[model samples]
Target: MALVFKSLRCPHCQQPIDKPLLKQHGLLQAFLKRKPFPCPHCQEQAVLPEKYETLISIGILTAVILAPLLLVWEVSFVDSKLLFGLGAALAIAGLITQKLDKA
Candidate 1:
């Protein structure tokens, strides 16, 4: 069986904590069960980060990369409308992924 260590300690206070997890079981417990993890040393509490909630950073980064590429293609071509399609697609994707990330 694989060992699973779930908690950590505050460096200064030596308080045990629910250290960051990629997909924490902390979510179900904190919200559903009403058992928010408390620090052993201090009253400080926390929640899973927004960036850690889902995998959207990659999509945003991809949009960033493709945005420039589309712009370059548009600049290099005679038919600028081709660039328009590409830019519109990238912008839509970026807006969508950004909303997803916020949620």
Candidate 2:
């Protein structure tokens, strides 16, 4: 399983808002900086869509599931290059799936 990031929306106006891809943007960065973005239409606070936390959990689970397999393969008879390449491929695929999944 991989994390699914749902696109956010303004709660009051129901306008679709772009979810931050990295921690640098959105409320996820509030710990470092709190920038208030007023809803363009309703003049209220904009919020991210629900289920983002679940997505994070899913992504973490995906990593946990993959890590041991990667480690085991590295220690086994599998070629190092093959093992590393496969691990990279799996990680990239997981990230792509999470990014591309529709809300």
Superposition error at 35 for model 2 (Å): 5.1
TM-score of 1: 0.24
lDDT of 2 at 29: 48
lDDT of 2 by residue, 6-71 (tens): 544555666654434323343444311324545444556543332433444454544555556656
Per-model lDDT: 0.39, 0.45
Task: State the lDDT at 9 in candidate 1.
Answer: 44
Q: In terms of lDDT, which candidate is strongest?
A: 2
Which of the numbered candidates is closest to the native, going by highest TM-score?
A: 2
- Candidate 2 Cα errors over 4 Å, as ranges: 1-6, 19-36, 49-54, 57-103
Compute the lDDT of residue 70 as modeled in candidate 2: 58
For residues 19-97, what per-residue lDDT tens digits would candidate 1 score against the true structure?
Answer: 3431253443552232343333453443333332123444444445554665676655444455445555654554343
